[model samples]
Target: MGTFITCAVTGGADTVSRHPRIPVTPKEIADAAISAAKAGAAIVHLHARDPKTGQQSRDPELFTEIVSLIRDSDTDVIINVSCGMAGDLILTDTPETQPAGAGTDLLGPRGRLQHLDRLCRDPRLKPEICTLDCGSMNFGDGDLVYLAPATYLRPMAQHIRSLGIKPELEVFELGHLAFVQKMSAEGLLDGAPLIQFCLGIPGGAPAEPFILDAFKQLAPTGSVWSAFAIGRDELRFVSLAAGQGGNVRVGLEDNLYLEKGVFADNDTLVERAVGLIRGMGGSVMNAADTRQKLGLDRAH
Candidate 1:
């Protein structure tokens, strides 16, 4: 199992306030992605933000501009736009009120896939792959939930399949993996399923070696798996995952620091991950190799 490294350039959430180097505009994102690709990342997991306020945006225009910029560049990195953006819900309560203050939230699967349809419909901007968060969880911060019931996931899987885009099943916990396997058994996910193990998020799987090993054992048979850890456990899990015959993911989207109190940029993260993989006698797969390995058809 050769290692394939993916750099999550910018997530469509509130990381800008935490990291000064998080790219906000399409130009910045495109540049960061290209830099990561040049360093070692084969796939660039992308999420767009509002240029002015740095708020997450699922608007097709923003996604289109970002994808186009990268496609026009010399970088040949495979693009993976996040379909994980639209399902977030944030609710705030008023101090004096019983219910709460004004917050944010979105309901239903159709609402979540609205942005996905826009991206998939644009022939010039179609991503070769998009994420399918298998199960709902309490996304860190505030009283919010990232909802993805089986009813929602089944249809979303069908929709992504119809679009000819590979769905990267993101499993944050053991049960999430089970759900993905069930979906695969149901003929929703095509080919050998691609699974991403997300570790060390609040309310999700903790960043423990044993936990990762358990999850690895639970991964769908014949599925391709990649692993990532957030915050302090980033590099530790990178080495562990690569050593354990799984690919690796590392970026500011998961961890803002390269070292204690040391802020790192996206390219630096990619470079470090590549170094670790190579140091461990693992070869990093290129975009073409990754596409072939993951059974993905190139986007024209």
Candidate 2:
């Protein structure tokens, strides 16, 4: 019930391409995790990057290295893997194209979850929490759409729950929240459901205070929730989320610049978020408190 902060260490496939300071290798991510923990982030939502090219990857080895590095550091931040990988989007050549392009890697629900299963199998790399994008929508600058129908989500939900890892339901819009509630009603999402209200993506929910408030109203009663805004509104939504009794998330995955033309690393983002949370008279939760608040069992 108290405020908790999560730092999304490195995100977006284009992050390294966009910012030189963004963490890329295992050591960099581990260092960033420690810095974030020191700056009051209780959780580090992880996404691995290709060491050479800095592109996003689901390689189990990469995940293992990152997790192990963090574990060895004694930082104690909760590790949350992204099950929302790159395999869901359908990017067609034109609006009328029946088939998607080579750039797209659309797959069935099970295929999308392959990396998640791999991570869950390793005791050392097992994520205490993982993401479950509740609904799908368009993701590109034009006509690319990501498919996440209930047909896909239901089976994925069962798999995540079976792994003994909590699913952080990522709701991009109010309708997505309604769908997540329906899943809870159907008993797919067991225990105290954790939800993340994602706002201000290109084709999803807009980042406005009223829009966030409406999504907050739609949250299942007694459920734990967090909220984040992408790009320019990241800090604004952190304040909004904390004031509204929800947790906050901030990092390079959602935004690149700390200020105009000024690139930010994970540590700077976490430091800024800590300042904002404390500035509003809200205290940031530690890893143990965060796990307790979200009903997550500590990983051995």
TM-score of each: 0.94, 0.95
Alpha-carbon local distance difference test for all models: 0.86, 0.84
Worst 10 residues of 2 by lDDT: 86-95
Q: Given candidate 2, what's the lDDT at residue 220?
A: 84
lDDT score for residue 59 of model 1? 76
Q: Supply the TM-score for candidate 1.
A: 0.94
| Candidate 1 lDDT | 0.86
Q: Pick the candidate with the highest lDDT.
A: 1
Tell me the tens digit of each residue's lDDT in model 2 across 1-300.
Answer: 469998998874586767888888878887887888888889998888888888887777788888888887877789988878755555566647566765575678778777777776767678898888888787757756767888989999998889888999999888899998899999998788899988998888999999988987888887888999988899888899999888999988898989888988777888888888889998889999998877888766
Residue 136 alpha-carbon offset, candidate 1, angstroms? 1.1
Report lDDT (Cα) of residue 106, candidate 1. Answer: 58
lDDT of 1 by residue, 1-300 (tens): 479998998886588889888999999999999999999999999988999999888777888888889988857788887888656565556545543323455556666667668877767678888889999899776677777889889988898888888999999989999998799889998899989999999989999999989988988799899999998899999999999999999888888999999999989999999989899888999998998898877756
By TM-score, who's the top model here? 2
At residue 209, candidate 1 shows an lDDT of 95
